[model samples]
Target: MQDATPSAIRSAGPASLETRLEEAARYALLRRLTPALRHHMIGALQPLGMLAAMLERRSQAPAPDMASITKKSNEMGVLSREATAACVGLVAWITPKTADAVSIADGVKDCLGVLETDLALRGFIAVNEATEATALVARAIMRNVYAAALLAITDAAPGPAEVIMQSRQEGDTQIVSITLKPREAEPMGIGGPSYRALDWEDVEALAKAEGVVLEHSATGAVLRIAP
Candidate 1:
């Protein structure tokens, strides 16, 4: 993806939002816009819009060539899917709810699968272990955690990001550890610790909602899903 996170952050600003809204209205009223404002709006919403169109096509089309669709749609399409996944995940379990029986390994893989194109574009190399810590945990927990990790990796990495995930079992728990290697020659100062920490805490909360135990250690975030 094109690091829309920066634009997403800018859009979150009170002043920026007000300005964007006013400019939007101004353009609509005059049926014209300053090139700058037009560019800004395009940068902000194009990915989401394109992704939606692709999704509509996919839903209506039968056995479409997913590889071709994804290949052509590119990063924006991936962003759109990620956004949809996040929205669905939030509504499904972020509120008061119980675990929905799901294949934890499959869920993680599905979430990661969305980012493969972006990862390749960014010149990053990643490997997922052949073994999976398959657990019958809440589908939301797996999706949220894996998505959060991908979001973080995308944000922090500048040149190339290396990702490795290990999955196995411990007694009655299924454990998965994710490790991210940032770009060389500089410390990670992209979004700061607060962003990563908030993502971390959110994953924990997501797991807790599913009655799963989660811990963060030096190696990586450890997920212990009880079967």
Candidate 2:
């Protein structure tokens, strides 16, 4: 008797080794960022939880204080707006907007926002010094490569460090540079999300996949993006 059964299904495989490697790198980057992303969501919604409990208690009172209830309602409205904005911003990191172009300054800030808490725990501070220059680059490419570059730089640091992100336009290309500034005096912390920091190879893979040019140096790396 021959047993015939279908094996578990999986998505179509990568077309080439390069494609496989690139996919692997992307997944690795996402795993490394999950903890920080989770923290951000919780932080954004924590206030709402507290306010909800307060409103519930007030509403249940035998003689509800209408004036107090109105004040809390107003407060809740403000907090709701803030929480919504925070969550929406966080979503961009996971699923970027469909627009073909994004502002260099905003892109840099968005990446740092997702990584700031995680980096701080790993003993690194990220500063967005990019000017308000718009670049014809996809958000996904900027995010993945920028994040990988940050991890690579900090991973090489011996102690606390400050990473400054800057961008400029030269001719037909926009250059986003990540520079590392060592901070030996400041103490580094130990508690953070447990994940391997991305390396140069990962950055290269991502850059290749997105058709972006990369220049690596002792200090840092620069990404040259073209429309």
Candidate 3:
């Protein structure tokens, strides 16, 4: 496992401190708005919800349309995975002692487990080989990095995508890099451009809030979270 030794001066690029702050502002607003937005959305979709329920009931009582049953089953399965991951993370965060050296790979694995259903449906693959860890308090930062990379990758490429996360230190600079390598030259069945750059500004905003800086690469899109 990598140690937590890092340079006193952390480096971030493209996004300046001011830009990161703005991002933080937006993120904060979004978080506050999410609950209300979700409630309103559900309220607006009540009719569709009722119709969906009717269809689901019909699908169950009879010999069930295998496709529809499978879809519903898959959705429930995804929810379970998400809930389980969240619980594990919460427990980890609340635990008093977790030994001195923790496995960064384990943390990313939990994050991947949470997104497994969506990644699988999109034909994407996530690989974690991060054999490093910082202090227990910094675990949340690593999770955020994995999550941001996952979102960028999902948008950049279609199914069969590839991502790798690892941690290492260059001299006093402790760096954790999440690299995304799409399977195809051009992303298939996605709305945006096939090979759009990953937005490190977004990640920088999160890092800023968490007290960190990051360097984001436009090509290949490596997110470097300084420790």
Maximum-lDDT candidate: 2
List per-prediction Cα lDDT, in the order shown: 0.55, 0.79, 0.53
Candidate 3 lDDT tens digits, 141-171:
5455445555554555434567676766565
Return the TM-score for each candidate structure: 0.45, 0.84, 0.48
Clashing pairs in 2: none
Q: Which tens-of-lDDT digit does each residue in 1-227 have in candidate 1?
A: 57668778876898666555534432231221122223444555667886668766885686887876667567765676776665554334333334666666676665555545445555555677723545666665655555554544444444555677777778877777677665554333333232122334444444554566777643356667776
Q: Which of candidates 2 and 3 is the stronger one according to TM-score?
A: 2
- Report the C-alpha lDDT of model 2 over 1-227, residue by residue, as the tens digit: 75544431223334466888888888878888787888999999999999999999999999999899999999999999999999887776666225556687777877777878777877777777885766657877768887877777777667787888888888888889998888876565575346776778888988898888988865788999887
Best by TM-score: 2
TM-score of 1: 0.45
Off by over 4 Å in 2: 1-15, 96-99, 191-193
Query: In order, how many clashes per candidate?
Result: 0, 0, 3
Rank the models by TM-score, top first: 2, 3, 1
Task: Show the colliding residue pairs in model 3.
Answer: 122-159, 123-159, 123-160
Clashing pairs in 1: none
